[model samples]
Target: MTRPLPYFEVSQRLSIKEKVGQLFMPAAFINDSEEEVLRLEKLISEHHIGSICFFHSRASAATNFEGKKEVIHNKNSFGRLKELIKRYRAAAKYPLLIAIDAEWGLAMRIENTPQYPYAITLGAMQNQAELVFEVGKQIGLDCRKAGIHWNLSPVVDINLNPENPVIGYRSFGDDKKQVIEYARAYIEGMYSMDVLNSIKHFPGHGDTAVDSHLGLPTIEKSEPELLQNELYPFTELMKKNIDSVMVGHLAVPALSHGKAESASVSKAIITDFLREKLGWSGLIISDALNMHAVSKKFDRKGTVECAAFEAGNDVLCFADHVEEGIRNILEKGKTAQIEKSFERLWKLKERALSSELVDGHLQQDEELMQNLAKESLSLLKGTFSELEEFRNNGFEYLQIGKQNGLFSELLSNRTNNGPNTLLGIFPKQVKPKDNFGLTDTELQLIGQTLKEKNTVLYLFGNPFVLNLIDWQQAKTVVVAYQDFRSFQENAANHFMGKIEAKGKLPVTLKS
Candidate 1:
């Protein structure tokens, strides 16, 4: 019996076209039509495509900012994903590197999987590295069970700008040290589960106001400033030997030597800065090439893909036109670059495909959620006794924005005509534009209620939403970081003094 050749030796034997084919990691939609699934399989067989990044559907993709297409939710998405993976794996010549954007959990992409708290919520907890590790481990387990090799998650961007349209709720917080510590814990957990993870949106997408999905976001900060704050977390985590680092689409003029090219397609940023300056030799993956930031800039079919390859990305993720991209790479005599990336990618595949799927830890996941909610629910204003007093006095309940059923369940018994008011402010949107999706009517109602009655406020969305209204009037103010059922239940418990609010606000709030 003969043993198979190593990935490097395998790369040496591959033809130039096959090597180029091994660089493209195109998007695979579980909710796609039969034709689409067959198309991907053809790419796998004939094209020898390297890897696949799964999304819920094309319409549900992050680049679908126009909302022109209707996204019908597929309840069977989880099973469909698993079956699709099996089918695709059978079609591939080499083991495919499966990846997903399951930052919070499989629930990030799939409909009915275990969902965990966002990073901002976890950032609110004090001294909870172990808990964060558990969240990562559980998410890794979900990814493995769903036949995913890589979890494109744990966004390490230090969110310094409050009005950042894309990365507000996704980021851990503004502090770099905290982001590094939590990211290290999460990465360690993923390693423990033998699941690959990527710390993403490199150099930092946190302080920019523009949404890269819709348009180009330029980071105008100096190189030193970026190195000090934005690049700090990635720098620290790189030292600990992370699996991969995802290059974002944003432009940094300082790093690009005053040119405003997207970092995802800039050799200066990916190779010079990340690889050489930072001494990072791990696999470098590009954030989706379908994003408007780089997508709209290139008019030709595979111009961006070739540029990304030349820029030093080992894997071209979500490349729009795979065949065109492969042809262009072969045409441009990029055999050396392709072979380099192909070898690195196969090394990743070796580690990724070796892991066995772990079983569900539903009870442990739930307990972790409960513990996180309890520890992260912050008391921004007034005492617990004040809320108790309001409850005792038969407080009138008024929900200002979007309603949460679980939270409203606990407030069902409160009277409408009571002297004290319990105000639940659920902002319709997470982004900071248009007053965090609050209407004038809602603002008016919040002000009138707080001014007229002794109000106890419960804010169940972005903490930045507190800046939109005059919340000081409320006697008791509790910041429940998310509207998840666990948070809602825990906030209700804290309202009744069943649990204490132990969390400090993760992000600073303006009055």
Candidate 2:
């Protein structure tokens, strides 16, 4: 066996075509057909493409919001994913750095895999950074088992705006310090597995109302306020030697010096602020280049890739135009910059590939997830004893939206004819837009039920959804941040006084 050359030596020996290809991290899909896989494989072999970011399928990618295609569910997605990764890795000229949006776990991208709680759920846990770190380590182990090198996760963006369509449930919470703390735990956990992780949506994407996937979202906050709030976590995390910082396609006029360009492509934001002012020397990865916020202007002509590279990004994630991007960067005579980025990328790639694949933490992970679920349940509006008394007094339990089978089974002994009602509301969607996907009828039913009866409301979704309706009339309220089985079972237990609800609301809700 021969020892491989270091990343510096390997990067220095790359051809011009290979150098340009090393900058692109295009999207890969597990559900891709043989033909589709062939197309991507051709790109990998012919174009010298260096990396891939896996999504479940074309329909599930962020660009599929308009329902242009049907989502075909593949039960063997995990098996298919491993095969696809092995194929792509073999196709590449160099060792490919496989990545995914596995913020919560492989479940974020794959169907039949383990899932940890969302960042917001983890954020709500009181003094549970160790649990958050464990979740990250478990997610890393899952990634490694599936042949993934990088997890584009631990979204450090502070969820300052409840109306933020894209990053609401994805973010930790509004408090900057708490967000930094939890993000550190997540990154540290990934580090423990020797797995590469990126602290993302740089400069922050949390406070904006618009979804950057559909259109551009502008942040009007002054630079100082951004530093104090949105940029605080990034600053703190950067200090801890983060592997990479994924810049989002957000328009920060303050950072852009009043220019309208997004943070991902703005040299003022990425180079001037992040690179120079903050003195960050780690790899800078761009958010998906296909997003409407940045791509709409460039028309996928590789202009987005060129601009992103020029702005300071080392990796152009989900770049739609690989050949065009390669040509564009070469045409601009950015050979030196390209080599710098390629060398930087190779360093991380070396670290990513050196790690051993770790597996079989399923049982321990389930226990950790259960502990996180129970710890993260918040008593937002009512006393624990009051809710326990309500459950003991034979209250009529009525579910508003999607039924939790586990919760329903646990509370099967409750009667429907009781004077007090236990209204368990499962919001139709996690995002706050479209009233958290609550239908007019659902809202009307909630209003009518609340006014008509002494109802104890238990919300199992984004806490922001509570602001959409008049939840004030409910006798008592409890917020179980996610609709996972653990949360449902824990909520049922809390209602029965089997457990104590100790979580504080991570974000402040409007009264």
Candidate 3:
């Protein structure tokens, strides 16, 4: 490893622009236009932006955007990213820390990469802590291969609300003990692989009904309540040498003395509660600055950036205006805080960069992912003999839920095109009127098919998808937590008795 200047010495050596550069880590996309490319280059070369948090414009799981932007898809996403990142590194004045929300691996953002099961699926595994560790290690290897320095994940938030808009399957589960153990194992795995991990949405975003990306949600819990439940994982994780903590964009009124804005840019919450009370010396990064939670409240864009800087956040993520934010930081005149943030950032940059980048060495651990998924697949109402018989006899498949994507992709291996039209089951978003989600009518079609032919109903979504529906009428029913291609494939294997169902329900299914 290359030895660099000590923190204090380096702090003394740096100019104003370099120090300012250390405090911003704005967002980056996979593919870009010529104009946007020039904009990024200017941000790096002139304003000296420090890092870039990468998100997918093409490989997005959610179809949230529409119109002309909807048709834009970046080709060969993984290869494109490698070339794009190389150019980004060359543009930076400092070694810009490349970060991504690889929660379940790069497949979460990038189209073609190794994908592990979600945290909830991993949490459901019995005595599979080592498997979870490998998941992290493999993700770290992926990051190094992709020229990424940081993995903005290992979401430690305890899932207190099944209705939580964003954090449902992403979190481990509702059990705090399970969440803590799994999070530690994951962190250790990533750390062992020499990639940095950040425990996210500090003080928790797991219990909210609203999505911060849309608007600010209030977590109306008392401080004591937060400490016992929501804050447990964060407190436990902090005892270890944690790399960074991403504060949530929540209106944690109790923690901030009734502040209207999210905790990400609250002085009392970040400085006094987290830094002083908890004694966290690692880097403190705000959640995405462009998020509506923070952006909607501030009239001018620069104000949010300035407040986040003053709130003691070491790095402001997803800031829309890098130049204006930097000017605001300078105008705010928090010289001491800026230097302190710069030194901490340098420490993280060195630790992350020192790890050797392994090229094409790590492939997605599909077998491991399958094993865990099989372990997590539950037999809600079925017999092993029946599954084996159906596999041998060959049952026709009928698909429900999302047509072109979720359902079509899942049963690709199964003979959905067979005679004696088989029933395929899909889920509807719990609420019907919600924008952009799969329809629930597929379940009804499966029900209709069950009335005639011998059918096996497989549910691949939130357990609440069966909230009010009577699924007991169908003889063989399997409820796999979420509907990704891997989950669907594993569900098929379980249905065929090739893989026995070892998974118990991670959450209680009232239906």
Candidate 4:
């Protein structure tokens, strides 16, 4: 009888194709179409890809907040996910681990599910442990239902720079100790439910003003500075044995040999600092390789994949051309490196599978959504008397951030009974005109609203857009932080003295 191969020996002997395949974790778009599902299945089976991340647009059962149409039912989503898993397992050399970036909850990534407050809101929370536990439990339940085993969340990066474009509301806060405290709770919560948690943007992506999705950001801080502030949370969390760390494509000239290279592919940062000095035995995954920060600079030279592996990243995520990238690495004779990375990858998968302890009471429920929404909403800065002032003043026009939802309708009903003079401002985007730029008509309407209304209640959804708005002339400015209906309503109610504004500003708003 033939003896089964030893796990480590088999891992060491994996073909270049199999070794390369272990590195990739691609995004799978899930629409109602059978073709999309078939394509996803093919990718999983043929490539033996390790994990798949889901996005909101890919979900089949999403619906507008007030809309009755369900985009996907929980049972259907669960069933389809299991079917896909079975298909991949049948064709794969090993069991594939599935994951999602469900930071706040599954609703953060998927629609028709309960939506929780942003992480910044949680940062403002005084009860870090309870909130973190709740967030983990909720995320764990939803992910388990969908057969997802990993959550790329609890962005442990310290939000030191207020102007940080990407890590804004995603980070816990700028305080290192607070970030560690909250992150530990979040990790404990997820791990308790058998879901692996990934603490991201290693050595901190918090200080940069630039978004990594747009271009590579360089940090000039020395190792000591990074250790004092940026690396504090990672060190604290490593003591707790967090499952993973995601390296961002951030350039630190003081830390790395070159200027343009990001930490994601920097050996000094990932291998030396994170693995050796910090002694993080957990898996290390790269932030999306396809992100412009790395791709735009290194794709043509075929340096990113090899560099990422050399930097000690076990999982190469979101590579635009997975097979081609793998082929290039193999041709470059980096098969041994690939096998080493695969061993780490397989070990993580095994750990995730073994962590499956359950809590029956922690199952997903509709009532929990309302509770989460209520708890997650931040009061920021304001007074209960402000609500009385708004109600008594009776403003004819209200300016709201340009978003489609129940908040807009509620503001309309409270102010002028229906479709009142509401001016909407767009959010910031990659292209200047695409985000935050108002049309001539929108600009004119906003000007008119400010001029006509004695009580101009401005509902600022995104705090970043506060500078763009003409806050100087407004009678009352309320920063809702987000445009979620619950938040908007809470802001309006707070202004009307129906509820007290208890939330402090999570991030600075320059007006």
Candidate 5:
């Protein structure tokens, strides 16, 4: 791997083009072809782009799998990422700072990588902040193994809005103190493994009804209200001397002096508020510029770069047009600002990536993951002791999950099956906007299962999923809080008396 150039030398010796290039961190993919590799090389070697934020590219043939695939879940994600980093680094004027939105873990983007439980699961293990810390350290180690320097993670948003489409499960919890506590523990753990992190969606994206990826979400709160709720986490992170903060594509009318501009391109939000008022001296990474919230407004060449740079962003991440943005930034005389931005970025780089990408702490231990999953298993409505009697009665299992894979697989080889063992697994694809309640088909199945035999309702979804059914109608209700394979297995073990259901519901269930 090519080593990073000294901060001052890279800044001083760089040509105007390279200096402007140093401000932009365009999005990159692990699955780029040789032709695409040359295009990235042109951006790196010629444009002198500073960094690349890794996201799964939807560039492959949909018929690559001969099917209609919504998400491009690329296999061998870690290995491909490592190779991509080496190629990009080899072509760069400075060693590219590889970054990712590993909010939960590397598995968020990359398939076949280690995945920890969701933030809500960690929230359930509130007393187990130490475990959260351990997992954070593990995530750091995973990042280093794949040559990732910055993790845009540990989302500190207080998830008070149940309707919040993007941040509901990603946030630690609704309580500000708990959110801060868990975030601090996770940050400390990541630091131990020498991985840098960013406190994301600054000024908080917790209370919005819309997903920022889809459009601009608005948060209408006065400065005091924001300081108490939305701004609380960032304040705490800043106190902890956080290395980076990612401003989200949000419209805070009050924060921006009643202007509708999103936080990422709002001077009143980033400069007057985050920088001067809050006194954040570290790097400011704008939320991905390609998102519709920002991109729709700034569609012309270099509009986003001009607005974001002038708005006081230190790094323009996932820019729509890197070459156009670089030229626009230089044309607008922001090269003077580039020096300061580069200095802050370089200082972060020197501390974060100076060491070899090897931290021997908790390297993807399955035992730890199982333990975490088990610890996070919340049998909210039913008791473990009740399972024995229910299983003896030959009860039907009604599973409401996003998919039919895991629970179906578990049922296929059931050893204690009886004639009355009716199994109904509803495969409802659960995303932020999807109904948290049961579908008509699911309701009918549950009704039938309930009447025929003692039905055990095991929901592998949001805690709010309980609202979909008269949970009291079932003989037993098991809430796993998530539908991950390990979580499902752990929940089953808890039911079978192999493990005690150690998790408690993190959020309050709707009546």
Candidate 6:
């Protein structure tokens, strides 16, 4: 039997074309259709694409939203994923690295998997390092079981601004040292199990009020200020040899030569500051290229592709036209630059292949999962006596959540069987419109119900939603960091005196 060649040796031998191809990781949708599978196969075989980022909605089993019985389970998700990997490996010149934005777990991006607390909740825990390590271990285990090699998570950005539309619950915390400690543990856990982790939104996305997904965000801090706060986690993580850093499209005038360019395409920020000043040699991947922050400025595919490469990014993730982007760089006779990018890209892939993939059997660690759930719940500002009183006094309990998942179900299970009457509320807010309106009737009903209820448990999907409600009337209020089922179950257990709430509020909530 022959021993497998090392990743570095394999990467060094890859052609320029293959190396360039490795830089383009586009979003792919896989269904049960044969044509979709074939198209995916062609992308791997002919284009030499390096990775695929899976979205939960894209891979979700068809579900009957209106009337039809659409796919609503993990069987399809797992089966399709297996088939995709099988096809990807069979057609590729080398093993294609598979990645997903499984920040919390597969449940965050896929259905049926256990939903852990959001990063902010973990950050709030008294045992942040342990919490993050558990999170990383569970996520890594799930990703490896599903044949995923990369996890775009452990959002290391410090939540400096409460008004930040993004990076709120996703962030570890506002304190630099706390963020570093928690993030380091999380990265180590992921790497320990062979799941490559990517720290995101460099130099930081935590201070901006605007969401970069909608448009460019400006980080007005001075270089020294950024180094102290925003860049702290990245610097610390890099010291530990983190697998990757995702560059967000943040417009930092202080970091850029001129005042207007985004950081994703800023040579000074990426190459000079991040690469040289920070001494990070790991992969530098751009945030989704299709986001308005990058796409809106550069309309042409070729121009965007050239600019990203020139700016020193190794991977052009989520490009609109991945093939065109690769061709433009090659056709423009920038093969040398492409080769450099490929060297970094292939080196990272080689590292991934050489690393120990996550063990699937750990997914069955029910006791460990339960303990994690218990530890991650937050008790914000209330006592067991208050909760017990509320439960005994016939107070109606209402659970406000975003979607139907484990979190909602756990809340339902906990509050439903109790003497408290539980009502689950789901709110929808479309982005860019800024129209977060509730009908007069709905508002009246909520107010009336709260007045009648003994306690109100608001399991916020995101902390931003807290502003939309009036929590003054409730006897007891709990903020479960996210809508993950584990969070909900944990929060419920805390409220019922089954577990102690050791988590602090990572973000402020309006009373």
CA lDDT scores, all candidates in order = 0.85, 0.85, 0.77, 0.65, 0.76, 0.70
* Residue-by-residue lDDT tens digits, candidate 6, 221-310: 788898888987888778775778999988998888756788898889899988988888878998877777777888776677667877
Ranking by lDDT: 2, 1, 3, 5, 6, 4
Index of the highest-lDDT prediction = 2
Better of 1 and 4 by TM-score: 1
Worst 10 residues of 1 by lDDT: 355-364
lDDT of candidate 1 over 1-511, digit per residue (tens): 1122478678668777877887789999878999999989998999888889898888878888468898868877788888999899889876677889988888888887778888888888888899899988888877877878899978999978877888988988987888988888888887888889899999899999899987889989998899999999989888875888999999999999899999999999999999999999889999999999999999999899989988999899999888888887788746667777877787877777665665543333667888989989999898867777777878767787786677878757656567887788889977776888899888988888888889889998888888777888889889998888888999888887888999988887663
Model 2, TM vs. native: 0.97
Candidate 3: worst-modelled 10 consecutive residues by lDDT: 58-67
User: What's model 1's lDDT at 272?
Assistant: 95
Best by TM-score: 2
lDDT of 6: 0.70
Give lDDT tens digits, candidate 3, residues 166-248: 78778888888889888989988889888888999897998888887777889888999999999999999999958999998
Clashes of each: 0, 0, 5, 11, 0, 12
Query: For model 2, how does the per-residue alpha-carbon lDDT over 320-358 read when each residue is reduced to its tens digit?
Result: 999998888888847788888888888887777775665
| Model 4: ten consecutive residues of lowest lDDT | 57-66
Ranking of models by TM-score: 2, 1, 5, 3, 6, 4
Name the runs in model 6 displaced over 4 angstroms: 1-14, 56-75, 331-336, 355-364, 388-394, 398-444, 447-460, 482-493
Pairs of colliding residues, candidate 1: none
Off by over 4 Å in 4: 1-17, 32-43, 56-83, 299-303, 328-340, 355-382, 386-390, 397-399, 402-460, 470-476
Candidate 1 vs candidate 2: the lDDT winner is 2
